[model samples]
Target: MIQLPLTPPGQTPLRVMTIAGSDSGGGAGIQADLRTFAMLGVHGLVAVTAVTVQNSMGVKGFHEIPLDVITGQIEAVASDIGVQAAKTGMLASSAIIGAVADTWRRQGMADTVPLVVDPVCASMHGDPLLHPSALDSLKSQLFPLATVVTPNLDEVRLLTGIDVVDSDTQRAAAHALHALGPKWALVKGGHLRASSQSPDLLFDGTDFFEFDTARIDTGHDHGAGDTLAAAIASALANGSTVPDAVAFGKRWVTECLRAAYPLGHGHGPVSALFRLNG
Candidate 1:
């Protein structure tokens, strides 16, 4: 493992920006991202794309943020506060995704900053978070600009039209997703119920790295994806390469799953606060 002091004495904490949505439930979206960023000892910045009426039960509804305001937040932060790496989650519409892509490119961050795209299309309870029309825009604009695109199994099928039943199919899906333009495609097999373990496949067009863990037995994993992506972005901001960053994220998130707790009356959230307990 590539070890570095996360918060060395007397140095500024690196900044990591998350362009995502607000979860009233507070288990996922911007809430989870910021929590993960802070846990990793990085400055957390936000460009909130939408506000959702959701809870541990599920998403009831959402209202998208104005495109201009979304872009403005990105500008205000990158221009002054500065972001070393960024990630996206729960963009509600094609318009928002396209605008985010355009704004990031215009700011000259398209190539400079590493971006983790967590394609959050639906809530864990099967409630849709993204607009129906936004899928194409997400792929056409945002995917091309991502350093690494992390997608759950459902998202893998949505992105590549492949059903990931095993490691073989996951690899195929990774290849198909890589063809969409991200430098890396991480196919998360957390939902692969047929398997005894959760295996994630990372492909960089030429090479493949696999990260897996014995599945934590819990229904309270609401923020796992967001937390993982946020951890990856945090590592990138702290100067880790993409592969190392993903590895770090996997380890951190696995620990989080071990500490997940029930919330509300339904499925709860994966605990990003796990480290605090340790």
Candidate 2:
């Protein structure tokens, strides 16, 4: 019989938690987050708030986990193992969002743990992931507790009634979003059609850091937001400052999109292991 080698103590990996939905497609949501955490050398934990029946084409259906179950999962992971940072994605309803925020506040971990909120209201294929009524609850409960709020043009428009088509509009939207109480707001420019290159605007309530990258024209970009937010959370868990983590996360996602693989009939997924291959 082969004997397993025993490892030394205190060699545990950096832990990061994701409070989000589970995508059966394995391209976005918690699945993408877990893959990103693994690639970035962080231990990934999940508190599943909903389960989505999605595919390469689009989201077929979804079911929300009970509020108690969601809170129980958060408590179970946060109490025993503990997490350095966390990210949220694809919350199904207003009640769910409120429950999660309340639980986190009750645990008194809001200040200690860095939380990245990816306001994922719709799928890349234009399918609705969040209920319409949940929008207000998300703004009221989740946004205030976030260390950083990552929103694309569509989500930013939904969050703040501003159209971010040009650079000036982008700046205005970023500042408006920052006023919503998050320490930082990263307004992504993937939907900005005027510019040939993608320019994401980052506002830390004071200054703006614009990250411009050549947009990789590919159909395989199913989990870009989840990937970015997860990478930021992992970076934070590894002791990076907010701005540094956002920059690193953007770089990682850009590389991932550049090396994306064609896997499905419709939009596939970005390669989360691009760094390893290089």
Candidate 3:
């Protein structure tokens, strides 16, 4: 847990950093994270990992940011402006993942600051964002440093090899992911389409907390995963407990879904325009 100043240095809002890729679509990745942070009253900082050519239709392709530049961005923000919490998105390759993990560890933020790992394997349109060879690196290096790992069903299967079809299996998946070393595991059930209301389960080794919400019928949920993870990271920056942060995030993203609107011919993004009220 991070203890943040109500008014950080230079009298700015509590700062939360998103060490993620840029979504030219303005739907997910660093774009969605910055929106979530701003709406939640925290200043958002970026350490862009990749520049993805993507939109409502799908991810066409991407260009990875150099490892040195990625590390430099992280250091530039952490050493100067500082961060109350941080989260990771599309790390395109094994080298990038290694760079981020090593930089974070060397900065001594692996334990001190709150870290949210959104194991983004693919886009909503079924496009692979991470390199196949980097999956092991993601698991081995990043997971152990995460304060909370937010993985959807697809990611859950990719990481833990568990098919989360029901509540029990969600629990099993949570346990499996927690074993990878994150202090908390959040298994999002937003991918479970058959259920009218599938609750996201959060496990902290011994106990389990489920955040149940009625399903909103909409296909414009392209950035829902990123939105949820960013909301958690933002709340952590705001000094919320892990359970409370997850709770707030669940509510926040549900509204984002409720406010979702269509953009392109295919699936659109959940609106981050659903700002938090004073």
Candidate 4:
């Protein structure tokens, strides 16, 4: 039987890390990741790769953090605090991707922990987040080390060249990504026709599972992907299997989206703090 992490006493909380960018608007990126971690009852750590000037409207510009600083943050956390699972998002350049991949390997996280990779190529508002030239490096250096790769429709198309117009093409996109060496691939269908039914496809190279929720019509789903990926990492750290983690993450996202609110005049972000509502 699986023992729960929350025991009688002296049990430390599960530790999860996010290797991603910082969003000034606090809607997505590390903000959303940490929010999800806290909500899911885990300790969150961060290694910010970029600092973006963004908001509900769109991303204006971003500055990639130096490789040394990124490594320093990861080492500081991994050596002392220790992470059970980690997730990566918004690796803006090839240099950063290579550096993170190297660091993660050196730390032995590739073999010891579950690493969820969110291929954040573009922002929720359609702003490009990663450099076009860094695409190959992300696929070559990081994808192989990932335990699970999470990509949306645009990212799937960017990585596989398949226009995911329907369920059949969506399956093809997930298989193409699974071919890149990640043990599992989760193709987010929130931006595809599957969004009508709020379905996300999970492919493990052999079989595919579709997890769905009632589609909530709202523009405040800006941080939904980041939140979902982070929640999965948190759940994995807390001892849930990949399928359970994905299902729980989807349910959590649906709840957040259902309670979403307008934070700004433009399209807003989902309410990660929805637990406080009831």
What's the TM-score of each model vs. the native?
0.97, 0.95, 0.95, 0.95
How far residue 265's Cα lies from its native spot in candidate 3, in Å, is 1.5
> For model 3, where is the 10-residue window of minimal lDDT?
1-10
Q: Candidate 3 versus the native: TM-score?
A: 0.95
Candidate 2: tens digits of C-alpha lDDT, residues 1-278: 10112224568887899999998889999999998888777789999988999888889989999999999999998889999999999898999999999999998888999999998899987889899999999988999999999998999999899988899999999998898889999999877998999899999888899888888898899899999999899888878888888888888888889878876688888878776664
Error of 4 at 66 (Å): 0.4
lDDT of 1: 0.90
* Residue pairs with clashing backbones, model 1: none
**Regions more than 4 Å wrong, model 4:** 1-11
Poorly placed runs, candidate 1 (over 4 Å) = 1-4, 8-10
lDDT at position 236, candidate 1: 89
Misplaced by over 4 Å in model 3 are: 1-10, 276-278
| Number of clashing pairs per prediction, in order | 0, 0, 0, 0
Best by lDDT: 1
lDDT tens digits, residues 1-278, model 1? Answer: 22334777688789999999999999999999988887778889999999999988888999999989999999999999888999999998989998999999999999899999999999888899888898999999999999999999998888789999987898899999999999999999889987899988999999999888899999889989999999999888878889999989998899888889999999888877867764
What lDDT score belongs to each candidate, Candidate 1 first?
0.90, 0.89, 0.89, 0.88
**What digit string (tens of lDDT, one per residue) describes model 4 on residues 1-278?**
11224433467788899999999999899999998887666888999999999988999999999999999999999999999999999999999999999999999888999999999999977899999999999999999999899998889999999999888898889889999989999988887763568779999988898897778888788888898899889878977888888888888888889878898767788877877555
In order, what is each prediction's RMSD in angstroms? 1.6, 4.5, 2.9, 2.5
